[model samples]
Target: MSNDQAEPETRPCGLTPKGLERQKRILDAARDVFIEQGYDNASINDIMCRAGGSLSTLYRLFGNKLGLFEAMMTQTSNRVFSAFEAVECAIKRQETPEQALKRYGHLMLERVLSPEAVGLYRLVAMDCSSERERIQSLFYEQGPKRINDKLGAYLQSQVEQGNMRIRDTEMAAYQFMEMVKGNFQLRSLMGIEISEAERELAVEQAVELFLYGATCR
Candidate 1:
């Protein structure tokens, strides 16, 4: 479809199992295309070719290329953050705040520093489209913002339990996430190899530092 074409007014919802599977296939193909070719260079036709779906179906499901990218990001973010459910369970079981944070930190590092995640970040970062703002917003809302909100909720729980002292759980969450990431994300985007030992060390240090600051005195 042309860039100027109006996006479909209605998007697919509550699809049958088959339809959902097909949609997943299309989204997976779109993710691969966007990551390999970057946003501007990627095309709907190319994605359809890889996904083996009709052009009309793709448009009906995703609305447009941007819509498809947004869906793909949302799916990917959900997958990555689903692992954090364990952290919540740990908290409910009265695990120490340090243990909970460390679990979150390790999971965050494993997912965020992944090649696919870094590729998606680079795709959004390097996008030069008229819809760049929308793309960036979608990525932030689906990815980083979700991560911060989850971690913030966890931190708030600790504060309520008198395990930590945080005036702004939101900011504290953002800070802790940044600390966990450190230079690894940048290095990954730049194609630098981060060893398993380095990732472990980074998470360990970040959790330690964050707990040191956040713990109730």
Candidate 2:
């Protein structure tokens, strides 16, 4: 093909590649600083020094301190949603409601027990007094409410197929999730990491309770 007829090829410029890497480095450093010092105490200088980048890049990439925090929050939201999406995809492929529910529970337990999630929860707890509204909104937007919505849809499908008897699926989903999260997650937020054995016990217990309640007679 002639140059005029050839399709244009995309190429990564040096600055573009370096800039993307720089942004990732900044985010990683910021996460570490936030984990160590919590949100209110973490400073831009600390992040920059740990990131091994300059002020100009930080400002250009994330604007300011609050902007950086918002960026981190957005990243966390995406990470959680990505996990949810993976569970949903697995559910779709399995074509079995019971298996889907089991996979969903395991995926959620994994996400909730992650170190970054633990740090974020701790940061929110510390900021709740002054940042109550933001924290509350983030919880609903990125966590419980979304998960409940997905579970409700899944339960409705199971009911339609006569695999489960789900009356008031939304409420059922909420109750089931509360049972799953009631104490373990609260302890996780308080920085008490549940050991492997404890997590396994919780998962098995939750699965048993859910299957007992939802199984068709």
Candidate 3:
């Protein structure tokens, strides 16, 4: 299945503008196929057919089915990380912790509960168990872990400035993220649609509670 696969942890490493565009087209098409067919049932040919690209490009760019899926995960991770960077900058600007938390929480919730995200989660749930280690590793290394690292860095900054007291920023990030979601994400992932107002209220309350628990004297 290996064609021109890069290291497990890298992507978009060498794609040119035109190449990136083609790759994106392939990815968008693949996403549709994966969402429609789920992982196991989906195939590169289907993707190629839908993408209007050759198998060579997919193999050359992604390597194989797993690589393609990881690329999908990568896209989602990149989107979230972009948002995290904004939050990081806002926090660095000395925005109120509550305000920053609300912004971050809202963005995170929106991304995780998106239609595409839910579809990916459902696809993985339906059929990625046998390769859980590979898929989970890909997802974690690029998605959750990256966000956690961003959050940990931000929290460490706050702690250094005496804005918060956290023994472990990593754990704090995990706790805060979980608290932000609570049962909301679980319900959303299960096909329960949460309203925008409800999402905002939940995150607002969660951030207040999170700050109360983490704020310094």
Root-mean-square deviation per candidate: 2.5, 9.4, 4.2
Q: Which candidate wins on TM-score?
A: 1
Query: Candidate 1's residue-wise lDDT over 1-217, tens digit each?
Result: 4742547767766899999999999999989998999888888888888989788888788887777888998888888667767766876798888888888888888889877788889989998988889989988998888878888888889899898899999999999899988998989988899998998888888888877755667
Off by over 4 Å in 1: 1-6, 9-13, 213-217
Where model 2 places Cα greater than 4 Å from the true spot, the runs are: 1-15, 128-132, 159-162, 165-168, 190-197, 214-217
Number of the top-ranking candidate, with lDDT as the measure: 1
lDDT (10s digit) by residue, model 3, range 114-147? 7876777666666754566787677668766777
lDDT of each: 0.85, 0.71, 0.77
Residue 178 CA error for candidate 3 (Å)?
Answer: 0.7
- Evaluation by TM-score, superior candidate among 1 and 3: 1
Pairs of residues clashing in candidate 2: none
Which TM-score value belongs to model 3?
0.85
lDDT of 3: 0.77
